[model samples]
Target: MLDSLKVTVLAEDSVPYESPLLGQHGVSFWLEATAANERRRILVDVGQNPDALLYNIGKLNIPLAQTDAVVLTHCHYDHTQGLAQILRAIGKRDVPVIAHPSLFRPNFITAPFFRHVGVMQGDEPADVHAAGGCLFPVVGPMQLMPGLTTTGEVPRVSDFEEVGIALSTIDANGRVVPDTMPDDIAIEARVKGCGTVIVTGCSHAGIVNILKHSVRPGERVAGIIGGLHLVEASEERIAKTVAAMSEFSPSLVAAGHCTGFRAQAAIYAAFGDRFATMGSGTVFSFTA
Candidate 1:
């Protein structure tokens, strides 16, 4: 287990009250995980706007050059648009970039005109490699440190939740099929003496399911952070999600980005002060 975890919101859809940092329609977090004397700086997702992200990084005094790794939670544009440029900014060769193998596959919506929603041009796997970043398409949970691990592919066990939007993709047989977003994943940090803290991105697999997949047999939930993707969900689903989330009793709920206001209000009502609005420049600290 790690000694402590510091999560700094590098970019988000909003800024804190009167904050000078720029906000965008995405999420990015700088994770500083400490295990004894060893510390690892991991970047989770890169918001669409590289300028805003870099500006906020400078304002927040984050050193991207020394970053240890980058983790992509999914293939959404908002989460991955600026990855290549960000990698170049790091000026490092072979920086590990972790994600699912289907990350570069075709993913999009049918209505509102045909448009691709997955990884766009420039930040493709080849682009990442050209930018001196090495891509690791993992099929199973991988450990970043002694206690920090990726959830791999989250199991869709929650019957009440679904992906906030309808997406489709083409299979190897050239048949159009429903995109279940098997790439949706999260980071779980098992802190010593404490419990598990989950950091997610656009939880298309459902937050409750991610939580259930994250927590061990007898472990408690220390905190929950990142977007829950309830922007397009029904009120019934939102209520059910909030009710189900309360069952886990997470110590903190800092949801933002495409989480939407309805779900945020319900989460606030359920979590009270434990529910915080994570925005650009916001920082959360946890100890063992």
Candidate 2:
């Protein structure tokens, strides 16, 4: 297990009042995990706008070049668009860029007039490879270290939770099927004395599903950070989600970027002091 863990929001949809950091409609986090004498740094996402993300990184004094790896939760543009540029900024050869095997597949929306919403042009697999980033497209939990792992493709066991958006993809048979977003995942870390800390990107697999899949036997969740992607969720579904989250009784739930104001208020109402607003430049540190 990690002796300590620190989460720093590199870029998000908002910033604290009067804060100098930039904000965008995206998500990115810098994680520092320590075990004994060893320490590992990870960059979760790059957000959609590289300029804003890089600006926040610089403003927060993050050591971008020293990042050990990156974990992309899904193929959404807001989360994967700037990956290539960020990898180049890391300047590390062969840095592991982990995500689901289907991350590069065509994901889009048709109701809004056929718009592609998956990884953008500049951040394709080839671009990542050319930037010295080694891609690890996986389908199961990826063990990043002794105490950290990716949830991989979470199971959609929560009946009340759904993708919420009308995203679709083309199959080999040329059928346009619903994009269930099997690539969605979360970062699961066992921090000593802190139980489990789960960091998510958009929770496209559903927050409850991700939570249920991340929590292990006899372990309590200390914190749940990142986007929930509940912007357009039905009120009933949001209420059910809040209820399920309350049952888990996590110590902290800091959500932002697509979590929607209504859901945030619901979460705060149930969690009270345990809920927090995650934004650009926000930092949460925990010690063993």
| Model 2 regions more than 4 Å off | none
lDDT (Cα, 0-100) at 229 in candidate 1 = 95
Candidate 1: global Cα-lDDT? 0.93
TM-score, one value per model: 0.98, 0.98
The sequence of per-residue lDDT tens digits that candidate 2 reaches over residues 1-288 is 999999999889999988999889889999999998999999998899998999988888899999999999899999988888888888889999999999999999998599999999988889999998999999999998899999988989988988879999989999999999989889999999988999999888899998889897678889999988889998899999999988788999998999999999999999999999988999988787
lDDT of 1 by residue, 1-288 (tens): 999999999999999999999999999999999998999999999989999999999999998998999999999999999899999999999999999988999999888888899998999988999999999999678799999989999888988877779999999999889999999999999887668999998999899999989897778888899999999899999999999888888889999998999999999999999999989999998886
Measured with C-alpha atoms, the lDDT of residue 19 in candidate 2 is 92
Error of 2 at 1 (Å): 1.0
* Candidate 2 displacement at residue 73 in angstroms: 0.5
Candidate 1 clashing pairs, residues 3+ apart or interchain: none
